[model samples]
Target: MDIPAPAPNGVQLHAPGVAALREAAVGLETAFLAEMLKSAGLGQHRESLGGGPGEGQFHSFLVRAQAEQIARSGGIGLAEILFQSLMEARK
Candidate 1:
């Protein structure tokens, strides 16, 4: 997902983008923010989890995965990939 880091010079964000690029990007941001707002509503589904089983299992899994990845790269690069992909797909 990391397109080769650009040259030493800063790469303009729209360098490889379309002719009406700003309009496209604005539409994408609108959809992205809406999706984020929709996801914010899912917090109500939280049922009290018992301490016996499935307590933070998937959450712990991701924590460990991210930890391992961070150990490799010294930071959460994968999370950046996830966020950027989510935003870019907004359109």
Candidate 2:
């Protein structure tokens, strides 16, 4: 069954069962990993050979995409734990 959830634009959208929970869990894990990567200087520019303003401007997007890919590829197991927690909370 679909459950009504609020979207960012204030629209009511239907969240479809476990799939939605899994997606959300993965997203959360991605965000967490992205932040961790950022803290670890994954996308930081180097003083000597930096890509300049453009690279600085879009480094976050690259980091986030990388993090998403990692999450989708089984990640550090955070997504699975989060998915299980979400499933338990929904009950």
User: RMSD per prediction, one decimal?
Assistant: 12.0, 8.5
lDDT of each: 0.39, 0.77
Q: Could you tell me how far off, in angstroms, the CA of residue 64 lies in candidate 2 after the best superposition?
A: 0.4
Supply candidate 1's per-residue lDDT for 45: 28
User: For candidate 2, which ten residues in a row score worst on lDDT?
Assistant: 1-10
Error in Å for residue 74 of model 1: 31
Give the per-residue lDDT of model 2 (tens digit) for 20-89: 8878888999999999999999988876775777778888999999999998888888887887677667
Highest TM-score, which number? Answer: 2
Q: Tens digits of per-residue lDDT for model 1 on 1-91?
A: 1222223234354555422443333344444443444455522223565444454445444444443434334232333343344445533
